[model samples]
Target: MSTDPRLFIDAPLSASAAIPLAREDAHYLINVMRRGEGDVVRVFNGRDGEWSAVIAHASRKGAGLTVADQTRPQQGVPDLWLMFAPVRRSKTELIVEKATELGAAVIAPVVTERTQSDRIKFERLQAITKEAAEQTERLDLPELRTSEKLAAVLDNWPDDRLLIFCDESGDEADAAWGGARGRGQPMAAALAGAGDRPAAILIGPEGGFSPAERDRLRSLQHVVPVTLGPRILRAETAAIAALTIWQSTCGDWR
Candidate 1:
């Protein structure tokens, strides 16, 4: 593990470039981390490769770092997206952070019929992803799409990409647990046949999707419904589990 601080510098990074640190980052390095002039750190922009940098100037007012040679070439995550209904603020942030660490290329909040928290703080979530990416050594941050209704997203979903629906509930009222039979194939089995197409995982809210929402999702040809397991998982757990399964089965982890 590297002890040097890693930062996501949004500027164009190149050899011999002197990039000024953002105020919060400056405070973190100078005041928080107690780093000073000539101290080395690592930096990366989504477009440029990772680079080693030396703090050229550090002060309470600001700090700057001079870019050194590239350390690693730019690499992108596999084309996998995570679309989950937002839960409580803390849990929602956890989903975003963990999704970034797990290498989701895009993070989208989808509002379902039973979604508890329809609103999202995009700026705050973006910060969480940036920090997560920095800590995880991801070459780039996941693209955080604005929250959208599940219906609209489904309507606009591209044909080339597949949507994996983490369906935990079904519409059969008389059936056990409202229809465990509604549970699609086990996630690993469904993903094993998903081929190499780009994919997204959709996790519903705590209350799960409304019957209409479930029906609509099931109606989609490109949607592959799957179950996490026999046990019911919390919204956050479901998101993490779904992402993990997808990555292991159909993404870069393979």
Candidate 2:
């Protein structure tokens, strides 16, 4: 059988040194996994990379580990970002988890005019992303940005980065309008030319972008509005779908 999946705990780790894992983590390893002394596990911090560790001690309160050896080099993710309006709590968690799995370099919540939810618990969301990355064997965790106004985000948009806005309204047009203008070429071809330049996929709120918001986004020079087919998709679904498309087109999917 494959080795047990490693976890991302808060404790610091050094090669050949012992570190005490948190009480919560200890319960998971000792109680949940039923692991005991001398059992091997893996651990990683976003900074130190991945390491093989052995369970030095386990108790109901916590667990301890001895860092053994570095198992892999730190991984580098693509320069893609997932910018979306925050949905419900469950869906928000889903987005964070799936975005990490899809290799999003950053997770940004953009507050649009029609946004329903304004409050976001950053700590909880970060934990979800970290867990997802550890389970998926991703050495890097996507940087989670605080919620920013849509207009503010547009104003601060980097000149070199391309914004792929998923525009549902573009489907009715006979010809490609907005970002779809140059989409005649295959996605792979378009992405190949993008090089290391940063790219972002913009997903709107549940109610979708307002007409004024659409107009403003379309007017931006860096924004490239693309269609996610003819169907109207929910905000969370659209985020995953758009990210998947981008990854397949220009990311590490190959």
Candidate 3:
């Protein structure tokens, strides 16, 4: 990666195009980073490929840049989405950040029966994803959707898209986490048969999925219940682990 600062611009990018920076972006580049006139910076707009831009002017009011040339053509991650029930504030932010870094094309927060934190700071999460994409050199930011009920999300799920449910609980009625009986198939094992289908990974909240939620998910023909491992994982960890599995098995990691 180049030492120059990278930013996610919202303007069209092309050679010689003069793009004005947003207020916050101007503050960041000019005041915070101390970048001045003629300083080189990297930029992307999710539409255009990465570009090399030179700072046109830097002042207290704002800053602007002139596109020098395209550095890389536009590219995108595989068609993978991550649907996770929001947890605590910090953990939820962690989930979104890692999901972006792990190449999730979309990140959604789902409300499940056992979900504790149904509310979310949408703009804050968006900022998190944008910063993650910038630092990770992703050409586009992941589509961060608003929080929705898991049932509603499932009801409208596309038939062609595979939904991988990370089910940590088992069918054991007498043991912790419902025992180990009738647990979902291991993640890698289940994904081995999944091929390269467009897919999404669903992770439940800290309490895992309610029995009814689990049953409904298992009954869906398009939903594949897969275990992360014998041990239970936090919502954020499960999101990261599941994305890694999918990417390695059927996504760009190959």
Candidate 4:
């Protein structure tokens, strides 16, 4: 792994712009990383892309950087969203981290009958996504939305966005939702039909969606029910698998 550190900042970055580091960031660079004046570090704001900046000084409990050159141009990833029912703390973190690394444009948490009542730690999740994006070379952080009821979300979903629902029990769903009748329709088949349309993936919690929730999802005109494979997967595993397949099929990986 590259030892050079990369950081996400809220300030604007332009050639010759001297960006002041926050106290926390200065501590990390000056103390944790043991960086000093003239050291090279990479930085990016979600909108500005990434740039190479040199440390201007190692001051009393703070530091500054002089923006040097653009390392990368601002670019957008495939317009893909990952909507999932929050799982246990660790698994939920796993989903967020993997989703960011895999290039999800948005991370939305949905509440279903099967989802636990406990609230997600939004602040921590944001930190996790930021760290994951930095580690994985993502130029932008995925947009994180607050948790919302699944019904309200479905009711107000944009008509142009296709929702690929990862139905764990696709074989057991009714025809209206494209269940067993759509048995041969794997996720790949769904994406093949999606073309360049804006898309989102919805994964249920560990116990899976309730019967009513499944029925409702199936009845949505824009929603496509898909199977990962013959084997059942943990919620986090399904999230990772679905993202990989989506990216390979029609995402930026193409």
Find the candidate with the highest lDDT and give its number.
1
Predicted candidate 4 versus true structure: per-residue lDDT over 1-254, tens digit per residue: 44678888788999989988988788888888889999999998889899999999779956899999989898878999999999889999999999999999999999999897448999999989988988888888999999999999998999999999998854455453453445425899878957688999999977778879877887789988888998988999999999999999988887
Tens-digit lDDT string for candidate 1 (23-107): 9899888887888999999999998989999999987678899999899999999999999999999999999999999999999
Compared with the true structure, all predictions reach lDDT values of 0.89, 0.80, 0.88, 0.87
With a 3 Å backbone cut-off (N, CA, C), the pairs that clash in candidate 4 are: none
Q: Which ranges in model 2 have alpha carbons more than 4 Å from their true place? A: 10-12, 170-192
Report how far residue 89 has shifted in candidate 1, in Å.
Answer: 0.3
Ranking by TM-score: 1, 3, 4, 2
Model 3, 25-94: lDDT tens digits are 8888887788899999999999889999999987767789999999999999999999999999999999
Q: Listing every candidate in turn, what is its Cα RMSD in Å to the true structure after a full C-alpha superposition?
A: 2.0, 3.0, 2.1, 2.3
Q: What lDDT score is found at residue 109 in candidate 3?
A: 92
- Indicate whether candidate 2 or candidate 4 has the larger TM-score: 4
Our tally of clashes for model 4 stands at 0
Give the C-alpha miss distance for residue 109 in model 2, angstroms: 1.0
Supply the global lDDT for candidate 4: 0.87
